[model samples]
Target: MRVHLGSDHAGLDLKNHLVAWLSEHGYEPVDHGPFVYDALDDYPVFCLRAAEGVAKARAAGGDDLGVVIGGSGNGEQMAANKVEGIRCALVWSEDTAKLAREHNDAQMVSVGGRMHSLEDMTRFVELFLAEPFSGDERHVRRIGQLDHYDRTRELPPLPESAIGLGPDA
Candidate 1:
């Protein structure tokens, strides 16, 4: 798989480890910068570009994935999702990482620099890389709606099937 990685100064160390690990596991890891870290360097610049790389690769051929890391990972995911066609999911656990790929077709994952041990990170990455998106019709429809929103800047219309049908509705 073609995997892109992006990290801020806070995540530089872990990112380095992940790149090596990915190579050993046969993934092509593409670095998106913070190559030489500065403490004040922002996560958005690298994260956005990483998402772009994956998006570009997917457009060129098959799907490509991206990983973005920062102190908390929240801003990194936010930044990655700003790019159109990038479904970025912030995952703190192995389960969430797997689910992000399986259920959301998430092309990008965000990890926190300070949240987990190296072992945990490895587990999360392994599951994320292994899981495949379910691609059920509902999931496909939902992602399509999101993609439409991204392209048209339009609010989603309520589905007739969804109206007044929830537990509280």
Candidate 2:
């Protein structure tokens, strides 16, 4: 699979390490990077580009994924989510990483470089890459709703049961 990666100064080291690790593990790692560390560098530029790469690849029918990293990964995740058709999940643990893929069908993941050990963060990435979306009916329905909302700027009507009122009432 093609994995796109981007990070600011805070995550540069981990990003570099992951690039090497991913190659050794038989995954193609594309670095959308700062290249040289600059403390004043912005995360959005690289993160958004990486997210866009994933979106374009998937649109082209290629199997691809993305990873964005920062000090807390909050901004990176936020930036990635702004791109249309991108579902970027901020992953903190193994479970969250797996669930991001299984439940959310996330095309991208964000990780905090300062929050955990290198091994733990890498493990989370591995779990995320390995897990497949559950593809349950409910999950598919929810994803469709989200896609519909994204395409149409209109809210989906709430079900009658959810509104806590009968059809006549």
Candidate 3:
């Protein structure tokens, strides 16, 4: 797998570690980075590139993934999701990392550099890289809804039970 990585100054260390780790583990790691640390660096600048790399690779029929890192990972995740066809999940635990891929079929994951130990974050990334999407009917349906909304900007209909329960009703 080709894993694209990006990070702000806060996550530079962890991002560098993962780059080496990913290569050592036989995955092709692409560093879309701020080669040198700058305290004022922006997460979106790098995160968006990483997300775009994954989106472009996948659109070309490749199984590529991405990782974006920042102090809290919240902004990085938001930035990544702004790219078309990119599903980026903010993963804080091994379970969430695995679920990001299995349930959401996410092509990218965001990690918080200041939220956990280096070892814990590393484990989460490892789990994320190893998991596969479940491809279950329900999961696929939900993903389809999201994809539909992404392409059409049209909201899915409310459930029958809630159809007449709006504030206007």
Candidate 4:
């Protein structure tokens, strides 16, 4: 898989480490980076590119993923999520990382550089890369709702069962 990475000065070290790790593990890592550390460099500048790379790859029928890193990962996740067709999840644990792909079909994941140890963060990424989205009917329906809303900017209507009170209630 092609893994696109982007990060600011705060995450430069971890991002660099991940780049090497990703390569050694046989995944193609594309760095959309601030090659040199600059305190003032914006996370969006790089993160957006990484997210866009994933979006474009999917548009061409390729299954690519992205990793956006920052001090807290909040801004990086926000930036990546702004790109159309990109589902970027902020993952803090191995379970969340796996669920991001399994449940949400996330194409990218955001990691907090200052929040965890190198081994922990790398393990989260490893788990994320290893998981596959569940193609169950319910999961597919949920993802479809989000995709529909992404294009139309309209809320999905509540189902009849959800809209009415049940006799058991």
RMSD of each: 2.6, 2.4, 0.9, 3.0
User: Which candidate, 1 or 3, would have the higher TM-score against the true structure?
Assistant: 3
- TM-score winner among the candidates? 3
C-alpha lDDT of residue 106 in model 2 = 97
lDDT of 1: 0.90
- lDDT (Cα, tens digit) per residue for candidate 3, span 57-130: 99999999999999999999999999999999999999999999999999999999999999999999999999
C-alpha TM-score for every candidate: 0.92, 0.95, 0.97, 0.94
Clashes of each: 0, 0, 0, 0
Colliding residue pairs in candidate 1: none
Off by over 4 Å in 1: 161-169
For 1-169, candidate 4 gives per-residue lDDT tens digits of 9999999999999999999999999999999997999999999999999999999999999999999999999999999999999999999999999999999999999999999999999999999999999888888999999999999999898767877665433
lDDT of 1 by residue, 1-169 (tens): 9889999998898889989999999999999988987999999889889999999999999668989998888999999999888999999987899999888999999999899988887788889999999999989888988999889989687678888877636
Clashes of 3: 0
The collision pairs in model 3 are none
Report lDDT per candidate: 0.90, 0.95, 0.95, 0.94
Please give the ranking of all candidate structures by lDDT, highest first, separated by commas.
3, 2, 4, 1
> What alpha-carbon RMSD in Å does predicted model 2 have with respect to the real structure?
2.4
| Candidate 2 least-lDDT 10 residues | 160-169
